[model samples]
Target: MRERIVVTGAAGFIGSNLCKMLLQEGYSVVAIDNLLAGTLENLPEGVDFKKVDVCDSDFSRYVEGAIAVFHLAARNCLDDCAKNPVDTARINVMGTANVLQACVEYKVPHVIYSDTSAEYEGINMFPSKIDSVKPMSIYACSKRSGALMAEGFKNYYGLNISTVRYFNVYGPAQDWRRVIPPVMSAFTIKLLQGESPFIYGTGEKRRDFIHVDDINRFHLMLIREKLIQGGTYNLGSGEDYSILEIFEKIESEICSGIKPIFKPELSGEAFRTLADISETCKTGWTPQVTLEAGIKSFVAYTRERLRLG
Candidate 1:
């Protein structure tokens, strides 16, 4: 009678890591991903995995009899989504709606939906509050639309759902295959190869980073504690660092003399992101990993991956 859980986007970075943690905790896991941006190499062992897009209306069958569902699939590149708003909405919005519909239909008792701090892109306020959101870009709009869809299910169907807005999440197994890879991964990949990576913008844009391990800890809490199941939590370290600062941390580990090249700022990205995690803090969860530790591990992991391949 081990509770089975279904995870969308299981082959992606966060999804794969979450699956690993769930398996270690003895939960029966079912995973789904489209493989468009995710890879099987990131897919965890000891789970029921399916190659399917969340947008597929028939995707509901995957949710049958699960104790809970974790929906993490999305068309989630800000710059890319800005360029392709239609596809962005179709996947981030409609696909989320489709998954919630399945959870409702299949009688799944709970769901955990992954949101983003990008919802606060338009606001100039420091330590952005979860409730004071003002999403500006089409990408942010799409993510917000998905949350609205989930809200509808909560109101009408009485479905238990926990939503979380993640700040800049980093660690090993991050989605390096992204059209525009995450800053940490992109930099590490290039630096590991003795190449100077381009630093988009002036490297002064600040970001609140939370390690994937910390996020997974929160995810476990959402599953075990009913108190964590009904509200949106901001997953961040409550501290902000500039892009250049993060680069320096990574560089300190490698000591590469290759200076980064500066480039024009990318559109659809926020100037600063700092999370107000007070609400989430009440859940007794705090981000445990340090930036230096996180970056060092990531660098090591990336180096090993490259060496093996």
Candidate 2:
């Protein structure tokens, strides 16, 4: 029998992509989602999918016999989380506790927790390392709380958990429906439609963008090698680009002749984010996708989607 792997938030961008990759690697996947943020169309075929919320009391049954679990479900939008901090805490903190409990109950061998680079919002340091974190926003705080919960599980229950903090991940199935979408999706979609995209702030906030494929490659390595137990890894390209630079790159590909409309800076966002992946590199898993190649493919993917619709 194929090894069983369960993924929460399976209908979302990263989860869906991970499911596709896991299926390709011959793992029996069980996908779970509440459909709050993710869509059915995003889910790939050939896996057992359950419409279940992470906070649901009965969510543990899905973990039975699974070799590993990827807990990705959370209230992650900055604005949304700011507006509904209570709900964010309920899902991010409490829901994570429930997932960890299930993992312990089921005796699952390992768990991969989906974390964010937003943990560094309050830190002014460049090339963020995993050693220090100071989360400022409600979303980041809640995720930090969840990370603390994971730490407790590792220390108390010996759950063998691996936490991955992602930096500006982008690719297909990217969430473009939020009130404020991701930068790549927002810029590409608007440009493709001949509409000018909005650039929050001065369009100079630097971010370390890593292609989703590179992230998934690291994930696969974690599963296959099981090299790190009770470890935290930073997944990024180790290169930083300003928002305007990204816009220019995308525009260079589409030749849209459209300029971005600058607006007030969004609150609770860092001025820059660059990852220090030295420890992760020691695991022999280096980022393979270049920003230029990644952006070109993303532009093509977005253009094709717009054309189809």
The top-ranked prediction according to lDDT is 2
Candidate 1 lDDT over 1-309, as tens digits, reads 988999998988899999999999999999999987788988877999899999997999999999889999998887778789999998999999999999988889899999999899989999899888888888888889999889999999998988989999988788787767899998898898999988989999999999999999999989998866889999999999999998888888988877899988887788999999998999899999998889888899999998998
Clashing pairs in 2: none
Where model 2 places Cα greater than 4 Å from the true spot, the runs are: none
List the global CA lDDT of all models. Answer: 0.90, 0.94
Query: Which 10 residues in a row give candidate 2 its minimum summed lDDT?
Result: 222-231
lDDT of 2 by residue, 1-309 (tens): 999999999999999999999999999999999999999988998989999989999889999999999999998999999999999999999999999999999999999999999999899988999999999999999999999999999999999999999999999999999999999999999999999999999988999999999999988888888656558999999999999999999999999899999999887788999999999999998999899999999998988888888
- For residue 72, model 2's alpha carbon misses the true position, in angstroms, by 0.4
Stretches > 4 Å off in candidate 1 = none
Candidate number achieving the greatest TM-score relative to the actual structure = 2
